[model samples]
Target: MFSLRTISSLWRTSKTDLIVQCQQQKQRLSSATFTVHPYKLHRIDEGPSTEVTCTRDQAINYYREMTTIRRMEAAANALYKEKAVRGFCHLYTGQEAVAVGIEDAITKKDAIITAYRAHGWTYLRGVSLVGVLAELTGRETGCARGKGGSMHLYCDRFYGGNGIVGAQIPLGAGIALAQKYTNSGEITLALCGDGAANQGQVYEAFNMSALWKLPIIFVVENNGYGMGTSAERASACPLFYTRGDYVPGIWVDGMDVLAVRQATEFLAKMCRDGQGPFVMEASTYRYFGHSVSDPGTSYRTRDEVQEVRRSRDPITMFKENIIQAELVTSDELKQIDVDIRKQVDEAQQKSRTDPELPIEHLYHDVYANMIGNDIRGITPFQRHKHQNTSKPCNITI
Candidate 1:
C-alpha cells in the first residue's frame, strides 16, 4: 500500500511537469511561422497586391483584441441597461474584426476617425478599458473628461465617435489633408456605416480626396441596415465599394480578421504610394441594435441575427482558426477571456465610484487662446469671462 503523502507528492510533480511542458510548447508555437489562407478580393479596379502573413503572435494578439472588444461592448450594454450610461450608446459588438484588423495593419502614427460605434477603435488605439467605461458612465476620469459620453471618445491619434451621421467622412479627409501637408507619411482611415454611405458629403469628400491625391482609406462597414431601414431598401447601389467611381475600391469579408487586415494593408499601401484615396467595403454585421434604445428586430428576424452570430462571429472565428493551427490551446484562450472579464468588472466598479465632471468644465476646453468675450451663463446677459489660456486646444470638442 502506498502512503498518502507519497502519492500526493507524485501528483504534484506530474502536474508541474505538465505545466512546464505546455509552456514550452506555447513558446515554440509563438516563434513558428504560419500562412494565412487568401481570399479573392472583389476589386472595382485592379491595384497593387500584398500577401498577408499570419503568425502565432499575430493570431494571439488578434484574438485578445477582438475578445476584449466583445467583452467590453457586453459590459457597455449592461451598463446602459442599468442606466449607468445614457444618451445614444452604440455598442460595437459584432464588428470587432473591422477595427482590430485595421489597427493591426496600421501604425500608431496613422489616424482613425469613426462614427458613434467607436469603443472598440478607441480601445485599440491606446485608450484604456477604464477610460472607455468611464466615458460611457460620464465619469471625470473618462477619455473625454465625462463631456463626450458614449458618442465621443478620443485618444492621441484617434479623432472621435462623432454623433452626426456621415460627419466623420469629410472630417477624416481633412485630417488626411493635414497629414499630406506635413509630409508625415501617415494615412487616415475614415470609417462610416452603411446607413451613412449615401450622404452627399461622402461623395464630395471622395472627389476632393481623389483629386488632391490625399492619403485616406475610406472604410464603409456594411452591416446590412441603416438604423431600421434595410440596405436593400435604402440605396440604389448597395455595393459601396463600387460607389467611388474615380477612386479604386475593394470588397472584403469583414467577419474574417485576416481578410480585413489583408485588405486594409493593401489599401493603405495604395494611399501611401500616392495613388490617392481608396475605398474598402467591409461586409460586417452588428449583433446589437443601432443604439441601446433600438430593439434592432423590427426589420430583421431573431433567427437571422442568431444565424449570423453562430456562423460568422469574428471573435469565435479567430479563436477556432488559432486553435486549429495549434498556435494556442483552448485553455489559454479561456484564461484570456477570464482575465478580460475580471479587468472589465474592475473598470466598471471603478467608473461607478469615480466623480462626475464639475459644472465649470463647460468653459474649460472651449478655445485655443483666451478670447476676450464672455460666455453666456445660466442667467441671460450674465456672462463669465473665459480664463483658459492654453496654447492650441487641438482637442476635438
Candidate 2:
C-alpha cells in the first residue's frame, strides 16, 4: 500500500524529470547555454584570476623576454662547455616564466631579489645582454666590474644573484624595509628555490615581514628539487607554499606564463597596498643541474626531465596557447628566434673581446680612499699646489 508521502515523492520526481527534459530541449535549440557542471564545482588552481588584459604588442614583449632568457641560458651552457665560466653557475633555462611573469606585475622602480639562479631576473629587469654575458665571462665591462661572477650578478633595480643558500630571503626583506621606510609605492619580489626553503632565515624574514607589514612577495621556485635532492627528500613540509603560519600561500602552475603573470600581478598588488608578505610556490622544473659542473641526471631520471620538457615547457605551452588564440604565428616566432640568436652571438663575441682590466682598477673600487691620498705615488697636491704631499722626497730640492 502506497502512503500519502510516497505518492507525493513519486509525483515530484515525475515533475522534476519533465522540467529537466524541457530545459534540455530548450538548450539544444538555443545558440548559447549556461549550464553548470557539478564536476566543475571542484576547486582547482585559483589566484587573482587567470585572465588578463594584454594587447598583441604586450604579448610579443613577453615572448621576447622569455626567448632572450632561453637563448642567454643556451649561450651560457655553450660557454661553460668551453670552460669559459668557472665556479658555481646556476642556469635559468627552464624557469623563465617565474621572472618574466613577476616582472610584468611590478613597476620599473620596484626591486627584485633572487637566489643563485638569477640571470633571468637581471635580464628581465633591463640589464643589457652584453653586460650580463660579459659579467659571466669575467670581463671588465660587466655590470659588477667583473668582481662578481655568475652567482653575484647585480644591477640598479635588481638586487642580486646571491650565492649563499636562501640568504637572499632576509636581504629581500631588508630591501622591502628600505622601500617601506622611504614610503616607496613599490613591491619587492624575493625569489627562492625549493632547496633554500629549508633555510631558517626564510621563516625569520617571513615572520618579521608579516609582523611589520613589509611590502614584499616571497616566491618559491619549486622545481621539484633543490640541486640534486628532491623536494620530498629535503623539505619536511614539501608543500613549500603553505609552510608557515600567518602568511597565506598559493600554489601556481608555473608552466603557464599567463597564469603566472596574473597571479603575480595579484600578489604584487596585495603587497604594494601594504597587505604584508604573500607567498607563492610556483610548481616549476629546471632543465639544467644546480651548477654547470653537474650533469643534472644523477638524481633525476632522463625520462622525467624529458617529460616536463615535452609536456609542460613554459615557453612552448605559451606559444601553443597564444597561437590557438590567434595572438601570434609560427613564422613570427621563428623570426624572434633568429633575432635572439643573432643578438646572443654578437654578445658572446663582445664578451670574448672585452678589454683586460688595468692593474690599477683592482684597487680603485676596493676601498673608499679619501681624497689627496693617491697611494700610487701621484699626489694631486704635488702637481697643482706645489706641495709635496707624497712621503717627503728624500732629496732636499
Candidate 3:
C-alpha cells in the first residue's frame, strides 16, 4: 500500500534500531569485569614473582566454602562458651581461605594432616557439618567416633587434628613415603602453625622428605601470633618459606583465595611430576585466639583485628569481587550466608542430641590385630581382663 521509497525508509529504520540494540548489549556485557588481586611469591633462591586469575565458578565455590567454614567456626565458638564442647578447641575463623584454597587444588586421592586447628580442613575434605560439630561435642556420631575431639577429627584422606605441635609433619611425610612406594601419585599436605615451625621435628621431616624426594607440601600457616606470643618475638626469622634449605619454597598471600589456589596448583604439579618436596608459607591471620580459652587480645590490639576484618576478610573480599563482576548479586550472597547460619545451627542441635561414646570403647581400635591385653582399671593395682572378642568389651569404666 506504501510507496517504494517509504518501504525502504521503514526497513532502514528497523535495521538501525537493531544495530543500536546490539551495541548496547555489547556495552553491558563489557561493563561486567573481574580482576584478581596480584600476590608476590617469594621463592627460595630467586626474587619474588607475581600471578593472579580466577573464573566465575571458582569464585562462587570459594565463597560458599569459606562462608560455610566461617559459620561453622562461629557455631563451635558458641558451643564452647556454653560448655557443650570441652577440651582444647582451636577455631579457624580468619584462616578459612588457606584450607579452602589448598583443598581446591588437590584431589580425593591426596592426603592432608594438620595441627589442632583442623576443623576447617576436615569439613572441606568432605566431612559433613554434623560430623564435625558432633566430634567437637564428643558425640558418637562424630567423624572420629567421639574419641578424637576438636584436636583430633579425622576422615578418609585426612590423617587427623594432631594435638602435638609439628607432630603431624613427620606423619604426613610418612604417608607421602607410602604414596611414593605404591606409586599412587598422591601428595600429602602437612600443615603447621608458625609456633610449630620452631619444633625440631618439622626440620627433621623436611630433611627426610627432601632426601627421599617424597611428595609432601609443607604448609606453614604463619598467622602472626603463636598462642599468645607474636611471631616477631617467637622466631628469629619469621620467613617460614625460606626455612626449607634444600627444598623449593614459596610465600603467598594467604588472605587471597585465588593466590593460594594458583600457588598450590603450581606446587602440586611439581610434586606430581616427581620434582620432590615443596614448602609454602601462607601468611594469614586468625580472628580468634590460639584456642577458645585465650582472649586473643593479650598481645594484639582490638583495633588490629577489627581493621583486618574490615579490610582483608577473605569472605568479604571474595564477595565484593564476585558482586562487582556481576557474576553474583549481593542479595544472593546474603542468602548463602543465611543458609550457612541455618545449617550450622542445625548441626549444633544435632550434635547436642547425639549419643556420647560409651566407656567400653576406650580400648577398641587401639591395635591392628586384637589380642588379649590387660588394661589398668580405676585402681592401678586392679587390672581389667580384656578378652579378644568380636563384641565390644562389656566392662564399664
Candidate 4:
C-alpha cells in the first residue's frame, strides 16, 4: 500500500507523461492545428470540434487536390470564353475547399449527387481533368461520352450534375433509402446551392429523409448568391443548416478545408451509426458568377471578390499554414503549382482538340446492360441501335 502523498506524486507523473506522449505523437505526425469557425449544431448537444489538426500527408494531398481543382476551373473559364464549352457552364473556382475536404472525409463507395456547379466534385469523385474538360466541350473522350455535358457529368457512384435546381436532393434521398434497404453500409451526400435553398421540394426531402431515418447528408453550398440575388435576399432564413426543423444540422467554415473535412467526418459517423439524415451549410464564396456569362460583378463589387481571394482563398490559406508548420517548403509548393498548371494545361488543350463522338453513338452511355431492356423512349423505326461504347480509358485516378 502506498502513502497518499506517494500516490498523488505518481498520478501527477503519469498525467505529465500522457501529455508529453500526446505532444510527441503530434510531432511525429508532423501535424499542424488550425482554428476554424465553431460549428453551430441543431438538435444536438455536441458538434464538430473547432480545432483541426492536419497531418503532413493530408496537407500535401489536400493542397494538390485543391490546386488541381482551381487550375481546372481556370481552364474551364478560358474554354467558356473561347466558346468551346457552350450552354450553361458553372465554374467551381472559389469553392474548391468544400469539394476537396468533403471527398477526403468520405469513401469512394459513399455516394455524391450535386447541382450544376459540379466540375470540382466530378473530378474529386473520380473523373479526371480531361474527362471533365472533355465533357464540358462535349467530346467523345468525356466521362459521359459527350452525352451529358457540363450540367450532367457522372461517374460510378456519382449521380450527376443535375440541371434542375433542387432536384438532386430527393433523388439523393432515394439513394440513401436504397442504401438503407440494401444494408450496404453506404451513405449519400446531396449538395445544392444557396440559390436552390428555398425550393419547396428541398423541404419535402428534409421531411421524408428525417421521417425515414435514412443515412444521408444534405449539403447547402452557400456561396452567398443564388444567381444574382444574395443569400440574404433569397432565403428568409439564410442559416440553411438550421432550416431542417427536426433533423440535426451543422454549420461549417467551407473555406477551411480541414474544417469541412472534420465536420463531414463527424456527421458521417453519426449517420453510419444510424442517427439518420442531417443538414450542413458550407458557408463559402465563389469568385466567378453563377454561370460564366453572369460577369460576377453586377450584384457584387469587384473589390469584395478580390478581398476574399486575398484573405480566404482556400489554397493560399492551407499553403501558409503548412509552410508555417514545416510540413512543406515554399519551393515544394511552387513546384506543385507548376506541375498542376502543366497537367491542367495539357488536359485543356487535349479536350479542346479531342474528337467529338460520332453521330451513330447517340445510343451509347444510355444503359449498362441492354440485354433485354427495351428502349421505350424511342420510336419503333430505329435509326441508331443502342450499343455499348466501351473503350480503353486512360483516366487519371
Compare the candidates by lDDT and give the number of the best one: 4
How far off is residue 137 in model 3, in Å? 0.8
lDDT of 4 by residue, 17-133 (tens): 999998986686587788888888889898878888888899999999999999999999899899999898998998999999999999999999999999999999989899999
TM-score of 1: 0.88
lDDT of each: 0.86, 0.78, 0.85, 0.91
Work out candidate 1's RMSD over C-alphas. 5.4
How does each model score on TM-score?
A: 0.88, 0.81, 0.86, 0.90
User: Best-fitting candidate, measured by TM-score?
Assistant: 4
Q: Point out the higher-scoring one by lDDT: 2 or 3.
A: 3
Q: Per-residue lDDT of 201-260 in model 2, one digit per residue for the tens? A: 999999999888999889889998888899998877887778746777777777666667
Find the number of clashing residue pairs for candidate 4: 0
Residue-wise C-alpha lDDT for candidate 3, range 206-284, written one tens digit per residue: 9999899999999999999999999999999988888887878888889888778877888898899998698899989
Q: Tell me which residue pairs clash in candidate 1.
A: none
Output the TM-score of candidate 4: 0.90
* Backbone clash count for every predicted candidate, in the order shown: 0, 0, 0, 0
